[model samples]
Target: MTADGERQVRAILETRTRAFGRRDAATAAAGYDDDLVLYDVVGSFVRRGEDPTGRLERWIASYRTGIGHEIRDLEVTAGADLAFCHFLVRISGTMRDGTEVGMWVRATTCLRRQGDAWTIVHEHASVPFDADTGHAVLRGEL
Candidate 1:
């Protein structure tokens, strides 16, 4: 049962990642619980429920030319009705100014199972900061 749960949770993550890579904000948001809470890397405060969708749309829009997302070093654990996964995500694209943008961010997701479907209830994405310089550390290993 644990293995099956893990597989299911992984499938959800995969689908969500694919949706995000395609810049399909609606499909990506569908994987999240209606009352989802997110601590986003780019934002200063926590985002609740459907608020992240607006941020996502703005982000996709910023990459006016093209965008690509890659997930790496994913690890997942699942129980009966709960699961958690963490991974490194790389987002690369061309910005509207014709400059290339690329970043590596760490992400963690907590999921809850409702009936047979798993939905993300909590998610956090962050990039390490250089304490001395007060700058984000964007380049790193997975």
Candidate 2:
């Protein structure tokens, strides 16, 4: 594993998390490739070659209060031209409907080196589900 490459990927992820907390959709979505493939926990099951910033903007706008977002247990693996990271993300905030929301989601991001920067080519975020109830387990520790 390339230490420098790992650091770069980690920095990108940390910056994105901070941007999300600040509700800066453009900055949060900046790391994604134009042809990004996403398997999100909400909304449609999959998205390909879609503008991520627009979707992020809408999600961020849904929170009436500033969002609280953090990443934990982050693990990164990097090589010359590719890298991947996995982490548990905690999101907490108040929605426009005055509902308090908080959940922990599993996330994995795959990136490709573009010149001197890395861009996320694919991302998957999901929550575990109960076997019997089929309900998502959103709140929990890893």
Name the candidate that leads on TM-score: 2
Question: Estimated TM-score per prediction?
Answer: 0.89, 0.96
* lDDT (10s digit) by residue, model 2, range 24-66: 9999999999989999988899999788999999999999977
lDDT of 1 by residue, 46-76 (tens): 8875565676778778876546777888889
Task: Give the winner by lDDT.
Answer: 2
Error of 2 at 77 (Å): 0.2
lDDT, candidate 2, at 37: 95
Error of 2 at 19 (Å): 0.9
In candidate 2, where is summed lDDT lowest over 10 consecutive residues?
133-142
Q: What is the TM-score of candidate 2?
A: 0.96
